[model samples]
Target: MLVRQCKSNFLGWIVPLLLLSITVHTAALAQCSPGAIICETFGTGTRGQLPQGQTNFSYRAIPCPNDGEYNVMDTVASSCHGDAWHRVTEDHTAGDVRGNMFVVNASYQPSEFFSQKAEGLCPGVTYEFSMWVMNINKVLQPGPCDEFSLRNPIIAMRIEQTDGTLIREVVQPAVPRTTTPVWVQLTMQFAIQTNVNDVVVKLINKGLGGCGNDLAIDDIGFRPVHPTLTIQFPNSTATETTVCADTRLTLSVGAATGYPNPVYSWQQSQDNVNWTAVPGSGQATYTINPVRAGRTYYRLRNAQPINANAVGRSQCSAESNVLIVNGRPDAPFSIGDDLALCEGTSQVLRAPEPLPAGTTIQWSDQSTNRQLTVDAPGNYWLETNLNGCTYRDTINVAIQNCHLEDIYVPDAFSPNSDTVNDKLVVMHPGTFTAYSFRVYDRWGSVLFVSKQADTHWDGTFQGQPCLQGVYAWTVDYSVLNGQNQERHFARSGRVLLVR
Candidate 1:
């Protein structure tokens, strides 16, 4: 192995020095690594498995690199507090190291990458492992894990045989060994395996002296894992699983491993133990038409195994969460329409038959997170989105509640069309929706009826201006509390017609 040191001009400056650090931290929720392998690779900011409120280095790989790949890990120290350390003290930094090969420290665990299989070496073909090493913080130990008893960074690189056994371990000098932050590189030469059906080299984090130390890794890779196969399939999942027998199943691919343009096949089974390919389509879905009366199983089958030569291969299949196939409930027990309420009223979209206490009612809203509350009027749907035959349903929302705020009308009104309260508008103290208002003379002749109070009366009826007098009006409206039922209220009031 050869040693290469890459340094910045601002060595002792904590703030500017820390700016050169490179990190790779990922989790199942983070960016998908090459070959669709999941890893906890976090970046300078808090993301995925990376710690919060702190910066750490991290990265991932689809498979272990035959030569070597980068490693992501974290470490902490208290004494020297800065981005880069000029003198050994205390402070934590996350980064990676490179050389002929590297190994993880005994204290911090780093992510690893391996090759699908080792290949025979050609003439003049020597395996080379190098990492763009960045020691975020170089500090001497103050306490427990921070104490660097064993001069080693939290990284280790090793090559494995086709059968997944270690053949050789690549060694590198302790990263951050110097008080000053620098990229002290190491390199080694290895003969490619001849009988090597496959090779898997990995970079990992070992507990460095059983104390807290951190580092970040990026661009961990093997340039020639596969000459022909350049892409892989990403992990796939279903937007929703358990559904009615006739319901359509939607599957989604999260991350793919090894090469793009890979093929996909969907399989179905009456019992999860047995599976049959869904005909006519290789998409991520399998709609079980003429569904049976019980639960069904579905899985994603790849055209080729992720590790073509690995033991048990990558058999990707997850059982359906579960769905019920009970026919629609008897009569009105399931069929019905609903009314809408104020934007803040609860509406019962579905009313299932009485069940034992604690019988969980599942809905499409996955609303299990909180109690179902209908605070407005709109189209709403709910279903058990499970794998049971009888666990699904949809519903509509319509509210018919009108409320009045109970307003006072002055005895005198200036039939003036001023923008501010120019007309005799209806007022109420409370709120309501879908309301109706009507006014009548002493003779009971309906003079005006309005659905909304955009503009009140102009002291005229049927274009024949009426003299100033007292008019009676009635308001009818409904209120939707948090229940399916609506409350109706009726009130009469007097308003004086003014000139």
Candidate 2:
């Protein structure tokens, strides 16, 4: 049974004798939330149709267990919604004990045979059929009487009218049984009419001959099909397009339509298959914000319009163009490189794209020096006001800001239990590849050493606490500056280890 949004909370009905046209308002549809459990169980006796059976039709009653395991089977036999049937014990033999119903391997197959006997039958109504089968396990292996040979066993159902005419017959797929002697259920569905009073529901095993394996059956019902709407976007093919990088793109739906007023949403996927909705894309004609400069595909999704109070499933549309962005210039242009003097100086800027022969070129940094002085840190770039089209490129410049940067220390300290800045710490910030710090007492005795400068001495030497006094410190280091050039420095100093 299909689920749809209705004005009321619960709508349960047996289909009427008239085939009524259903009108779906797109505005009343909504997306079904995750993890919803829906069940449509037509009552017993209204299930399973009558296939073309030449002989007897029978049903048996069964016993309910008291193990208190009120799970699917337990609850089904005992609860209000528990409409499942049990096996009849009175028809059991020595091997087929009481409370066991068996379906033998006769002419049982899937979707092949059907029976119809219409003494009371109708049109335009819906019906449901359910059956119970259990293993008697009377015999051992595969034979004419063994249910295990019941390969591809299916049930075929049909409804016949008074004039020997076939009204409706539903052939359901067959089920395979295991060696375990448990009960299994089969269900079938059909649409019927109201004038039908003495309509027949047939249960025939297709494929398996009359002497097929054995199982039992019971309880059927007739119920109504729920209100649902399905929509599709016709003749739409996924396409790909190429555009320049970082360019905003607009995608349009091509040759597609929906039943309900369709709401549009846009989704993107880098790879052609997996797609996700773009943020803030809950409207039609979506605009890509700061469009990415790459080959990205987008899809258009259509949703069923939702009414203020309706809640149901929303249908989806197909994907759209795969757009690409291309950059300009086609290749990287070069500018002439020149060196500056005085150690920390910088060279004037130049544009690789040729300029007028007499144009005055200004050095970047606003310095009139067509050349930069060797002193500080900064970046350089150039621009020329030619042809009204501004062309520019920037080269980064860095200066050595930290120079007296070698390790230094004080020589005396008092560890007489007073607190102040009392430890020797090697400190500097930026990137470092490797470094070592060493501290020596008056006699040139190595008191502490560390590869990591952050590790400071708290008046401790070689696991034993040392007395606070004067300490000599020395450090060696190498640095890679912002330009990725390496330099080395070594320095010695005195540190007052105070306490």
Candidate 3:
């Protein structure tokens, strides 16, 4: 979308997009800004005819032609010139399907092929003129002539005043042939001197007529490329561009811009791909509605008001980098997870509070209460809103059973087939760090031993059942304390094992 102005509030700060009409500096040729003030994409589709030109060459309606002739076609078969020319499968412009390129077969003598008068340029503005060119001659030939001995295409582009006074001329070197179509873009910059609002662009052939000097050209573009504009927040050295929500702040280029009188366009987007212009006149300042609470992308475009082709049909504009704004409330809080509760006990869960006035809260259980009664272990969440910012937070809860005693060992057990107390096992409610349970005989011989909490003895020695009498048992273990440090403990007792 296109607009001349836009405004957004950054945490109480209002950011306004402004269109500045600055003074023009000396028209010295220099650096480039990526905006299209004049672009001839050659447009879509195959013309299947010759483009209007100022050349002495013939206009061929066919895709392939002899010397001193040219054609505008999307594709030229490699077999068109008896398999001598490289196959042109696509246009020089990316994503331009079935787009035509200007194909030329060199004349016997050098001559001018293109000449046009460009007007509406802002005085003192420097512009970059560029076009994509490709050599259509195959590197390897089917003829007796080889690449080293064959001629190449050399095109020259010149810029001059309307009366034909020379400004600058760039003559391209002979473009070399390739196995496949290889497009190269030629670029040159020229400045519009004071009071100069028009200029003439011309293209001339400088190569000798030969079997290998065939070429194609497309996507010509020209635009103001000097005194680049950079938009940044105050404290330009700091990378922080964020402003507080709901604030009004004016953004400006600050320094004097050297481009005559340029028009500005402001635009905003949810996603950077699609843009909507900010609405306003071509003035220095305009207002945009208060920014909504989310991330909003913005940009400022600079262009000349005078009518160039791109400006008359679409406006010659250069857009700025995207500016992102976010609105947020600094209220942050948290709840505990993996909580421990004693047997037959319950705990209260509180929504993050000590909240500001006019704040609202809702628990996951649909409870509006500030504190919730939780009896079982599970998950809980809270949705909160204060001022104009909203937030949702969640926490998980798992039951951790704890007892006054750390470990519990069975006193006695029988190895009978019946599912009675047939195994001696250790039981504990607290988490274990290390443990060893063992049973010893009267002679101090190790009779049974285990390391795992779930492992047990079957009142037997190897494969034989133990004698029906009392057996000495001992347990050495360690369990984690409140501070998560291990506490060592030992216990020894005599248990009667009935086998």
Every model's TM-score: 0.25, 0.28, 0.48
lDDT of each: 0.41, 0.42, 0.63
Clashes of 2: 79
lDDT of 2: 0.42
Top candidate on lDDT is 3
Model 1 TM-score, 2 decimals: 0.25
Worst 10 residues of 2 by lDDT: 66-75
| CA lDDT, candidate 3, residue 371 | 86
Report the C-alpha lDDT of model 1 over 1-499, residue by residue, as the tens digit: 1111122110110000001122322211112223321211223322222222121222233111111222322332223234322331211223322111111223334434222333432211223333334343455565443553633454555667656677766445445544544443333334444344345555444434333243333322221122121111223232323334443434434344322444555555676666666676454444445444455555554433332222112212221232222322211124245554664557554445553333345555566432355666565554433323344445566655343334445545656556654567766555566577887898999988888745467767898777777888887776555554667877778877666
Model 3 CA deviation exceeding 4 Å by range: 1-34, 38-45, 50-56, 80-82, 93-96, 140-149, 235-246, 250-319, 326-499
Give the range of the ten consecutive residues with the poorest summed lDDT in model 1. Answer: 10-19
Residues 404-475 of candidate 2 have per-residue lDDT tens digits of: 344445465554445654555566655556778887889999888888867766677877777656677778
TM-score of 3: 0.48
What is the per-residue lDDT of model 3 for residues 219-281, given as tens digits with 9 covering 90 to 100? 655555545444444445332245434444444443434234767666678888788767662
- Candidate 3 versus truth, CA RMSD in Å, comes to 23.3
Evaluated with TM-score, which candidate comes out highest? Answer: 3
For all candidates, what are the clash counts?
Answer: 110, 79, 21
Query: Which portions of model 1 miss their true places by more than 4 Å?
Result: 1-124, 144-151, 178-180, 206-210, 221-499
